[model samples]
Target: MPDPIPATATPTLLYRCMTKGVKDAPESFEYGASWVTARRGMLSVHQDRLECGDWTIPYSAISQAVLFKTSQMLIPCYILKVRTATDSYQFGLSGNKFWSTDLPFPVTREKGRLRYSAFSIIARVILIAALIWYFYQAWA
Candidate 1:
């Protein structure tokens, strides 16, 4: 039903970070800002805190991203500034792990035929075990 990736190509996950922002902003952004997720090649922005709506931002759309840091008294503040073709977004987040790294990274490990990741499989098993333990405790 769908085209498969070429055998020569290996999918690599570079970096991921969570910020707060939205697109086509309103009168005030604080109220409209939501959790925005940034991955190696994409950014997922939820419209509201509940994730009622969303927008996907590809790395190509991003023209520039600036990282700023300032210390207040004894504390430090971090900010991520990203400029797209049509808009600018500032997110208050700590750490510059992504901003400091080189992009379009190559895959470090070989992948299995199945698409499921080892972490996802582990998480599922942990969740099931927790559920079972909860039920057993309730019954006992």
Candidate 2:
């Protein structure tokens, strides 16, 4: 009888090969560029300001796609060291799934984070007040 492949070995093989899977881009995701191509995994970026007025944002994270689902997904990975140049930004990210809708992609993890801008808050308040005044006048 043929020997059964060990569960431990399964992951090793998966890491070495790509799988055909379904992909999606949620409407809430907006960063870099996202698309469902023939590949699986995510690419993360970081930027360094050079003295020449150029930006160096490299793809510094690559992890194996541990799970790919329509809902919550998870990837066990780490970011690579930044690669910088005066005229460009170069880095590499390799994981099992490069793009996913499950969980947060590498950079989009900040979507739910606390970002308080006084200007933004003030703008919202003014807009709301103007809207209320318009409606009140229209009704009166």
Candidate 3:
């Protein structure tokens, strides 16, 4: 276990992420079409607060932190879910540093389940077929 970051220290970690949901969110926080489209942002972890876009959540307000996995475009995606007394926030993380010991709370990890939508499945099939044809033509 790593020591918790001090309040004055620089952010412990930063990740490229998409905000997926925000329950009981602030008025200025926009969550429109987040489920359908990517809302790219940066998630920064600090000793005191979690900053992402228009939201700044203090660790004291966080009731739970969970790390789980989902999929997008047939690719595995890691999700960080942070819950407060009255609010919950979900972020789809990018890059490899998905866990940190500097967090104020212990993050509960869940088993990953691959979920493929019809569109993604069809697209994957088409991509595989195209690759096979390309290889075959190249060999011929």
Candidate 4:
């Protein structure tokens, strides 16, 4: 018989966003540049590098990850809350709906969209400041 699914385990779903023939078939779903981690019990995921990041509490923390195959392609999948057996686990964009996978992210709450708009404004201001600084330095 298959192992029972844990009750505390939450379902997180990610959608694949890859276009055709861009990524090598073998390494298409795996990420080389970025990774994600979920703070225990918080439904939010944060991006960080593999080596220089907080230790993820294995099997307890869940992360929904997607990697760029190109700017146009994405490989999305749901990673089961699993204990880290090895030093690193290979993340694959498997289409498997193992253990009753459901998209943990809710459809409601447009908070992210609003937050991104705020970020856009802040970024514009920072760019403007940087330009001013550069020009001043050049004229000085």
- Between candidates 1 and 3, name the one with more favorable lDDT: 3
List the global CA lDDT of all models. 0.42, 0.30, 0.60, 0.30
The whole-model C-alpha lDDT of candidate 2 against the native structure comes to 0.30
Per-model TM-score versus the true fold = 0.37, 0.28, 0.54, 0.21
List where candidate 4 sits over 4 angstroms from the true fold: 1-52, 57-63, 68-117, 129-140
Q: By TM-score, how accurate is candidate 4?
A: 0.21
**Candidate 1, 1-140: lDDT as tens digits:** 12222323423333334445444432221322132332212232222111112444455666665545543344554444455688765554434444344434221221112123455566678899999999999999
Q: Per-residue CA lDDT of candidate 3, range 1-140, in tens?
A: 23333434545543333445454423222223343554455566755678877777788888887877555566665667788887877776642444533445567876556355555567678999999999999999
Provide C-alpha RMSD values for all models, in order.
15.7, 14.5, 7.9, 15.5
Error of 4 at 36 (Å): 16
Native-vs-model 1 lDDT? 0.42
User: What tens digits encode model 4's per-residue C-alpha lDDT throughout 1-140?
Assistant: 22333334434312221111211122223322223232222122222122112334222332322332111134333332212333333232233343134333221111111012444566678999999999999999
* Per-candidate count of clashing residue pairs (backbone under 3 Å): 0, 11, 0, 5
User: After TM-score superposition, what is the CA distance of residue 58 in candidate 4 from its true location, in Å?
Assistant: 2.7
What is the per-residue lDDT of model 2 for residues 1-140, given as tens digits with 9 covering 90 to 100? Answer: 22322325633221122222122322232222322232342222213111111222333332212221222134342222222232212122224353333422233232122223555466678899999999999999
